[model samples]
Target: MRVRRLKWAEEFLGSAEVVVQSPQDIKGNWNTYMNRECIHLEIGSGKGDYWIKMSDMYPDIGWIGMERNESVAAYAVKKSEEAKENRKFIQNEAMHLLDYFDKEIDAIHLNFSDPWPKKRTTKRRLSHGNFTSIYKQILKDDGELHMKTDNSALFEYSVVNILKEGFSIEELCVDFRRETHDEDAISEYEQKFMNKGNPIYRAVFKKVKEEN
Candidate 1:
């Protein structure tokens, strides 16, 4: 379903200090804004639930939430403001991630990303080989890529593509809610699906440093 564009989204987002209208402006200086050394980024961060909560849960690590839709990005920004957190929000597409971030990111999170179920659109999936290559470029040598989704097909596809990209699967869970750890904070969509008795799949892929 298409999100209804909020008439005041642009104006509201413009006034939000947490929102970065042009991510490229910050580029490699993301940590400078949050005043932290380690930074973690979340792609397709819907309504900022996970990132915001995680930011509070881990005060030492910086957080950045990237979302393309202005309407939804606005809500994420609002949540950040309400929490009095300095977490950053990028109002841009994930495809152009390199333009906004450098190789300083310590980790990347993909929470409930679009499955892109069509065969022809498989390459558009966030965990596709092409996208994984892009992620490898920005992520540090030991950086981790964590992903969660309720769509079984996407989870399986992600595991295949991640392995093909030379990433080692550190952890895997076909049913996240039942197997989640104490530190894991549930996102809004995740909680909603879990309430409906749907199983959530999760994986942690780490880039394997090539032996010189």
Candidate 2:
């Protein structure tokens, strides 16, 4: 599908590197436009609107969003320029997150990722162990992964999968909107789901230290 070009997306083009190669393009050294510490990553950041808002809200933390779709990534990169102090968008696949980020991220966010509901397509689900293993590689010790979903089956599967991957759940909410959730950021998909009367599930899991 051809993505509609947003007027704001044109400004940041070519100013940043378009990371086609996985982890190879992610530089550990801080640049004048990038942040060196307290970095956070978001996978499947469709248009990056939510993360852009987050970057504005939190000035001290660096934010990066991974979106394979060029058009969507463009939108994110454009908006990031508004709060260019510490935010970036990578045009890469979710499966290659570890390739682009080292073990430096403080947190990772997954918002309404592909459910891959079919029995035969389970491996494609973002919450599967394979993806979590990749997340573990790029996450710092004690790093947190925040996930939200509207699919009940996928949410249940994620709880089991994350546990199998040695992560401990710190928080889980089946009804986030009604629960005592802080006035947190909401993704575009999240708002759409809420309009349809669907409930959202939220969870935070910490990476367990690997014992030799």
Candidate 3:
């Protein structure tokens, strides 16, 4: 996802009010920051369509969007310049997620993540075991993970890895867009995929609390 550098992108990243400059410092106080009782996080939030729209749809919960790319993150913030106080952006990668959150997140969203469709790059997939292990540590007991993708291979890989990593599937949909899903917002990539007749796959995995 090489983006042609935008001149204003860097400037916005430096001063965007919605961008959390030091997310780690607010690690355990996310709810306090958003003034919401529940919190949701979206990793690999490319271009911010889902992030911004989801926040608007669910105004009662705290919504945080994380993206490693500075320019892309800036664009997301720039697009939602008047983003509500319930939303925030972390300009960082998934690997560093634990530093910014505790085991208090209510839900996590993975929307059209990079498939990293190569044997050598398997570790880079957001649903990989390594990332799931981090997710397990940071997600509260019973917290749910919601993932949607147009790639069948990636969808299968995520299901296998998530189940292996101590999660149980609560729901699965092969052609998620076939029926009306007014509760969820369609991403820019998703709209394009739907227009091309691609089937969307969605899964909801819940953290299985360790038995005492």
- Which candidate, 2 or 3, would have the higher TM-score against the true structure? 3
Q: Residue-wise lDDT of candidate 2 within 1-212, one digit each (tens)?
A: 14886565445444565332335655444232364468878888887767877777777887777887767778766555553657766776777665566777789888888888899999988888888999898888999998999999999999999989989999999889985544468767788999898989989999999999
Model 1 lDDT tens row, 17-128: 7777777878888778678889899988978899898888888888888888999888788777663345778888788988988887889999999889999999878898
**How many clashing pairs does model 3 include?**
0
Ranking by TM-score: 3, 1, 2
TM per candidate comes to 0.92, 0.85, 0.97
Write candidate 3's Cα lDDT for 1-212 as tens digits: 56777788777787888989888999888889999999999999989999999999999999999999888887788888795888999998899988888998999999999999999999999999999999988898889999999999999999999999999999999999899999999988899999999999999999999989
Candidate 2 TM-score, true structure as reference? 0.85
Off by over 4 Å in 3: none
lDDT of 3 at 113: 95
Poorest 10 consecutive residues of model 3 by lDDT? 1-10
Number of the top lDDT candidate: 3
